[model samples]
Target: MDGKKQNKKGTGVKVALIAIFMIICLGVGFIGGSLYPLFQTSIFTKDSLITDQLLSKANVISQYIKSFYLEDIDQEEIESYTYRGMVAGLGDPYSAYYTKDEYEKMMESLEGSYCGIGVLCQKDEETGDVIVLNPFKKGSAYEAGIRAGDRITKIEGESVKDQDLNSIVAQIKGEEGTKVTLTVYQQSTEKEKEFIVERRETENETVTYELLSDKIGYIQVSEFDEVTANQFEEAVNELEEQGMEGLIIDLRNNGGGVVTTAQKMLDRLLPKCLLAYTEDKNGTREEYWAEDDEKFTKPLVLLVNGQSASASELFSGAVRDYEIGTIVGTTTFGKGIVQSIYPLKDGSALKLTVAKYYTPNGVCIHGKGIEPDVEVELPKAFRNSLDVPKEKDTQLQKGIEILKEKMQK
Candidate 1:
């Protein structure tokens, strides 16, 4: 079976999104249960809480690895004797202390821009289907046949059901030119079939626009990054100069980028309305205001899907609430929590959940995602994708139909 593996460079994704503190995994909820009381703040400092048992375990592990392990152990590889003991002592699978290099890698992902498969992917909680949010025309996944709403149930032989999103990403990403197999479930047939996808480099952050006959303009936003707001602004200005009327802001499969950038886009779109709101601790709140009057007041249609999350969720929530545009597609990724990266005193950092972002309607889409006015789910069979479809894309056809009606109006 042949399937295309989407390329993902471990660079620009916000690992700890503010999705209400989606942290510590669904595991290791407590540290050593009863033993944790022995190492509480009252008894021990935050650093040295390990018992002698842990130290002995670390020594045994180190000696065994050095003498009998298959791989060679480097002398400088160890952090500190205390650190080794700490890992052994924690007894919590979820809690981990990263080395400096690992810590830096962890922090670099928050900018939300990456060079890989141009599609935003998310696991459907109900079906465990891997759905694409949006697709970049130039990326390999788009070229392969991954569509905005295609659900993947199996990666090779591994069932993706209940697997974490990170695990799915790891299975899909690899060195360029490698292929991964997937059993995609199309909405038409509702039966799973296998397909192999080869990995390739995916570069994004380029907002392209085109005149779609007369005053209608098509704007494809690849991904939101540090400069997306500015880039989209320029694109809007050019389209307006060309006498743009209906604007199609394609955010399908857009896993979301920076909140500030999304806020910038909202500022450009909603104009004077309350674009977005975030709440911090103790009733503290921050509201993002529009930068100026709305740029294009024409009928706008936002394309979204299950992969639309974080910043994109914020944008869609505001648009739907303000009635600024028609949000077309399936329900969006329910990620309402906001996370702010806190730089720790040590070289490592703490990516803690900071606040909850609510849409203008005071709706929280963290666990419950946003529902589109028009619901167009893909049938479980017959090549369902926004990329190059083996059959037809009901979602795209519906969007175009809705946009056409809006244009006629």
Candidate 2:
């Protein structure tokens, strides 16, 4: 009789707990129902609603992939692809999502240094061939007999035909002291050979300057990297020390890089004035300026071509607007927009088109390139040549001629 009484007590406690749980759940439901209208009206905006739908669709697709996919799935790769796709959906060609490795490589390029064989290359658009533009004299590639104008046909015994240029270059670059083999086709000799090159830390020479005839300084800028401004200033100062009376800045085939580097270079050349300005989607204007501490008051000539874009155009546009230099060669490549890299906590990055930049005179060159004061086309014979003779470079000749005329004044 005592045992039966204890069992009844235990059953009463269990029933009490169940009743309390149900009451709490009912209270929660009542509170949630009361707040539903508030949430619908304030929290769930149109954009958030659309985002919810997108997330729901993504979840459905992910579940199907997980449940019925034929092969093993890489969750990390899927997440990366999702991030890339999100950025690519914006439909802007200049914007992109970069993985950790890609972001690191990009930073290295912008910093103007890397561990590689030290050969600059470009992809031929028409032929889909990777051609060596320059092999640094002290680099391993140059030491191994690689020369400019040679076509890179294969990397590490794999054919690079129609391969992405970045991938090919990545294959060529490896850990320091590692060996990379390259098969090069020399068009001049009509010969093909394999080169065993060892990778090492190499610095990019973005600015090359020399004193030309009649005390005129000639500086060729390949790209505006982080170290470019300092190099350019040093070059200009050295040229001035050598009695440089006029200057010619060659921006031919120079695809732009860091925008601030161009601004810094302009700061050294221009006086106190508004350099350029950018306007974002909200019409918020940000301006760049050049102080009057230093200026190049001598005759200046800027040579630009169809491939001169972005920061190159910025420099050219500023020079033209200020009336400090005469712009020669063809019109610029017309990229007036600016891209800002947003770094994430995961070591990845997103480059987005942030704003449209304009010259000091408020001229936007997007889709409408900066016209040269004197337009000169490259001769057909020199167009295909990697190294055109100085006398045969019609556009450069025109620039020199204009600088001489200005100097005489």
Query: Tens digits of per-residue lDDT for model 2 on 1-409?
Result: 0000000111000110000000000101110001111112335566553487788999999999989999999988998899878877897655667788876654443232235787656555445556675677778888898886787788888987644344455567656777888888986788999889888876567789999998899999877655679999999999999999999999876656666778889999987888888887999887878867688899999988766666788899899998999998877767677655566666776766777878999999876678889888777766645577889888878888888998999
Task: Give the per-residue lDDT of model 1 (tens digit) for 1-409.
Answer: 0000001111112122211111111111111011111112335445755567766987998888878988766664665334534544554222334445544533332223222345556445445666654555666666777665567788778898755344455456554566778777655566666777766665444477877764777787755665568889999999988988778887755666556777788888776767667776777877776777855578888877765666778888888988877877677766666543333445643333446778887787776778887776655452234453513656655666677788787
**How much lDDT does candidate 2 score?**
0.69
In model 1, which runs have C-alpha deviations exceeding 4 angstroms?
1-97, 107-204, 213-215, 382-391
Measured with C-alpha atoms, the lDDT of residue 85 in candidate 2 is 82
lDDT of 1 at 399: 62
Q: Which lDDT values do the candidates have, in the order given?
A: 0.58, 0.69
Best by TM-score: 2
**Estimated TM-score for each candidate:** 0.59, 0.74
- Top lDDT model: 2
TM-score of predicted structure 1 = 0.59
